[model samples]
Target: MEHLAYFDCPTGVAGDMCLGALVDAGLPVDVLHQQLSGLPSEVRFTLAVQPVQRQGQRATQVLVHPQGEQPHHRHWAEIRTWLAEAHLPPAVQNWSQGIFQRLAQTEGRVHGMPPEQVGFHEVGAVDAIVDIVGTCIGLHYFNITKIYCSPLPLGSGTVKTAHGIMAVPTPAVLQLCQQRQVPIYDNGIDRELVTPTGAAIVTTLAQGFGRPPALKLERVGWGAGGRELPLANILRLWLGSPPASALTEPVVLLETQVDDMSPQGLAYACERLREGGALDVWIQAITMKKGRQGVLLQVLCHPELVAPCEELLLQETTTLGVRRQWQERRLLPRRLVTVMTDWGEVAVKVAEYTGRRVNVQPEYEDCARIARTHGLPWKQVHQQVLHRFWQDMGQES
Candidate 1:
């Protein structure tokens, strides 16, 4: 069971946009308001869902408005206290802390004060507060287990704000981004592509960076950015499920046969490739026309490393030339874990979540050591290790 949150931030992202995305993803607006009321503050704000169009496509926009009284700006500490007391799930609580910290650092840098000395300006006001808190509430409402986004679209040039004209993507925006690595960039929108509150919220809540992961897409939610543009100002929300399998980011392969190189030196070169995150490396025995037998070395890596690896080949071995190709590959979702086994501790790579690991593979190095010590078949020892992990998980459950 998984939900995919896609950021259509080619225009930039904001807290309002994110909240709108969640609302579009099925989080109820009234439930969001109900949670906000649990906070200690007496402030009043309203959440409005409005229709917005992006690139000729209609999407929903979330608008936060101060319903009656004039809104006042509060400092970071005061706002943090209210949020800490706000009713939220654990993930949402930490998510809120990260958001506020990013917001403060941005505001501080914008005002030319040290990040710690910076306080919230308009962001601390009632409506913006609603935007940030409601985003957290909506996150829980949708039961989104994980959040991910694309590189943020930070517009180029300068933007005029309440504090006067600051650079687009603003000092606050940069500060918030620095707090966490949420991929962001100025892609020529020329207006503020990402806002301080938006950057903080997205960067903090999102789990990892890259193109949206492969998943079972359940629904598509569109969040309006409120401001109109000649183009669309809406954020796209894609809800997905785990696929039986999925295509991943493309990697360009550069390979060639190297027969004359010494095995030790070639092994060293392969180490260097793996260190730089190469996908795979192997060598094959082949015969040349002259009838001399040698090992043919091949290397595979992402396209970006072509130059670096090419340099390594030039300096590390006698490969005169390498061939490059555009190739496609597929991979299963993977993770790591250490399981308790008889040979002490063994790292296990498990596949298929059948409420329990259907296949648990013992780390080969650990198995080898255990087999050598106990004079047991390495394969047999490895099987026992998995049996132990399953027994333990069952007892614990």
Candidate 2:
């Protein structure tokens, strides 16, 4: 079973709040401390977790207290090196570094400097580092396979930072949101709810931002913030297992009909679309209005690529407009396995449904390459690859 986590951020999200939620969801504090102890000697901090009430809602509050004097400002290169030298798990190290990298890039853009040269002020503190790294450690400990989050709530008014009083949602926070195209709304709260650390953490780690997906309801963890507000100042984390049927994901289908473009142009357009990240691109002959012979072009891609794909079609083809629709496609879990054949090694695609192997086929590209190299018939090479795969698996073809 795959474990999934959903961040329902009605108030907002921060690195520390994420850690607290993970802890409240049953992640052991001792485990977090033990793993965090692997950081460099210069990094010194301790976690403090306690039950807290936010606007009458019970939640866990996690605080990262600096243990000793630490640098008030650190460059991105310095933090990157420290994380690389840490003795943490590979996944933890990668994720922690990725979060900080996003922060550095966003700050660099705001301050007109390179990412490596950007100096982190408030986020460079030992406490923020613990919040970022500890959050990764918690997620790794829970074995979370997928993450979903709600649209972030943006607060109003200004906030005090190491750089002095800055506008609410700050420059770095707004830049991060814009980069990820994260959905945000003003909640009429005159405070800085979503900090730069919070924005960087969620925007970097979350796979999608919207309503939670269909899941078997499990435990909910509430991470409380540091202030009281009209609403509960808490970040809610929903953890559960999604059904096998949830394997289906939403995709965008872009379609256009063209009769003026030459066949070569249409083919070129299709290739460009494929190179631009379209999952599939194809064309079919069709009769348009007035009995005109035309071709219907279709492109399948993730929602994020819809704009670029459409732009490519418009620029590369004679189509005046592209029709788009969202679709949910159920997909079989598949993997590639290499098999040794007489000519060379060929890859075979294995597809599974409901945990049972449903189909197996040799990759045509791999088979064709080997066939050309060995001066053998393509069909014969394909058969040999399949035969070798079945033979190695000890199964009858």
Best by TM-score: 2
Summarize candidate 2's per-residue lDDT along 1-397 as a digit string, tens digits.
Answer: 6778888988888877888899999999999999999999899887789999988789999998887788879899999999999999999999999999999889989999889899998899888898899989988988888777788888988888888988888999899888765778988788888888888888888866666767776888898888898889999999887665436555668999998989899889999999999999988999999999999999998755777898999999998899987665667778788898877688899887766678899999998898788888999988888778777873632
TM-score of each: 0.68, 0.77
Q: Total clashing residue pairs per candidate?
A: 12, 0
376: Cα error in model 2, Å: 13
User: After superposing candidate 2, which stretches have Cα over 4 Å from the reference?
Assistant: 187-190, 216-218, 250-266, 282-299, 303-329, 334-397
Candidate 2 TM-score, true structure as reference:
0.77
lDDT of 2 at 289: 97
The regions of model 1 sitting more than 4 angstroms off are: 68-72, 106-116, 178-187, 246-348, 352-360, 365-397
Cα lDDT tens digits, model 1, 1-397, are 5555656676788878888887887877778778778766556766678776677887788877775765466778877777788777776677777788767766766677775666676787777777887788876666777776677777868877667787776877776665554555555566777887787777776754457767677887788886776668877777765565443443456666666777789889889888877778777788866788876667776544556766676778787887766454555555457777756878777665424445556688988998999899988988888788777653541
lDDT (C-alpha, whole model) for all candidates: 0.71, 0.85
Q: Give, for candidate 2, the lowest lDDT window spanning 10 residues.
A: 242-251
